[model samples]
Target: VTAVIENTAGQGTNMGFAFEQLAEIISQVEDKSRVGVCIDTCHTFTAGYDLRTKVVFDQTFAKFHEVIGWHYLRGIHLNDSKKELATRVDRHNSIGQGFLGMEIFEVLMNDPHFDQMPIILETPDDTLWSDEIRLLYSLIR
Candidate 1:
């Protein structure tokens, strides 16, 4: 089973705000081989791990690898944030139309590390789903 970690947004006693927390949870699970993680882009960004730039993206993923290992990465919740980096807000916006911008998604879509992993859209606007899906597909190299 894959566990999707959520951002606390400075809310009441919420865990999984950091990658390490998720790692710890996975470590405690008895059936470790069957467990994995699903990272949400917006939550990750708002939690202070930047993915908007190539350098930052590399650094962020490196940190994740160090804390949780790449093998534990099962999927991605692909969403742009409505808040700026490190705000700890859990708001979602349409692709290329929020604080995360389009570059991050472009980089992620083209990255081989996430090649076969499922990337899900959590954008707020239902009317823009078609455009968002098309935009993400267009980023693939």
Candidate 2:
């Protein structure tokens, strides 16, 4: 089953805000057995959750577990952050080039659980998306 919703574009609302809120709602459902999360890195960062550091990663993942456990994380959009933590900015830089850097992405890509999930890039400059994808792919084992 799929949960289709409108793209997040509203005043005072960050990209991932809807997703985060959706996660919360999904958590309350009596039958969440098939529920999962689709994380767009740009949106994730825009929502003020930094995935650049191990500490941040742990915290973010922890919050996901608290708000909506790991069983719900179904997909991921691998994009880089264009702004700092809590900036509420929605700019998406090419992978490895933004504030998130390549190191953290490499780590996430190597993670056993997350590595199996589909990671699509929503980064801009479509002409260079392939190159960015290749760059991120290279970081994985």
Candidate 3:
């Protein structure tokens, strides 16, 4: 099995939390070429990297590309943030109820580059997994 380092940034000093730090760590590693990122929307949004608006999305993603390269974006955690951008709080709400709405999801789904990647939902509705999953699928599909 291969170990990929995923960091949590914002509010504290975490390796993968900041795009620059994550990319820097990846660059210095011996397995730099093989290292990638698993960007959790909640973490990214909480870390002050807004993904809701196209401008913010483009700028944040551009940073990712410039630093780590898109090839290193191994996966995604498809979570919506309950807090505002740069709040540095990592609360995840259900699919569309959070601050980041369906539009961002549409963009993610339409992204051909990330098509082959895996996205996981870490919503807190444990008892409503079926409902939450269905809602997420409907939004993405």
Candidate 4:
């Protein structure tokens, strides 16, 4: 079984807020393939990895690939943040209903890089999960 370490919102003294820290932690592992990383969209944005626009998404993910190799990516948590960018808060909102607009989600749904990864929805409202899933699926074009 693969053990996936997820990125966090970097609230207060949190350590996994940045890809650099995650890279450092991941680098220590003796068996690189045994463990992997799961990126949380909300946490990533709150930590300052911008995904508001395509260019920003490209830049942030490029940095992530540089710091933490793509071979170690296992999953993705698709969430919208209630807080603003670089806020270091972990508040989650419904998809396309928070600080992160719908465009990013639409782009992400179509991004081939995440095709094989397990995509999980972590919206604040559980009742909206079905709708969110449909919305995400509709973005795949």
Candidate 2's clash total is: 2
Question: What 10-residue stretch in candidate 3 is worst by lDDT?
Answer: 1-10
Model 2 clash pairs are: 36-72, 37-72
Worst 10 residues of 4 by lDDT: 26-35
TM-score for predicted model 4 compared with the true structure: 0.97
Error of 2 at 128 (Å): 1.3
Best candidate, TM-score = 4
TM-score (all chains, Cα) for each model? 0.92, 0.81, 0.86, 0.97
> How much lDDT does candidate 1 score?
0.84
Q: Write the per-residue lDDT of candidate 1 for residues 67-94, one digit (tens) a residue.
A: 9999888888889989999888788888
Question: What order do you get sorting by TM-score, best first?
Answer: 4, 1, 3, 2
Error of 2 at 24 (Å): 2.9
Give, for candidate 2, the lowest lDDT window spanning 10 residues: 4-13
- For each candidate, the alpha-carbon lDDT, in order, equals 0.84, 0.69, 0.76, 0.91
After superposition, the stretches of candidate 3 with alpha carbons farther than 4 Å from their true spots are: none
Off by over 4 Å in 1: 1-10
State each model's C-alpha RMSD to the native. 1.6, 2.9, 2.0, 0.7
User: What overall lDDT, based on C-alpha atoms, would model 2 receive against the true structure?
Assistant: 0.69
Residue pairs with backbone overlap in model 3: 7-16, 9-17
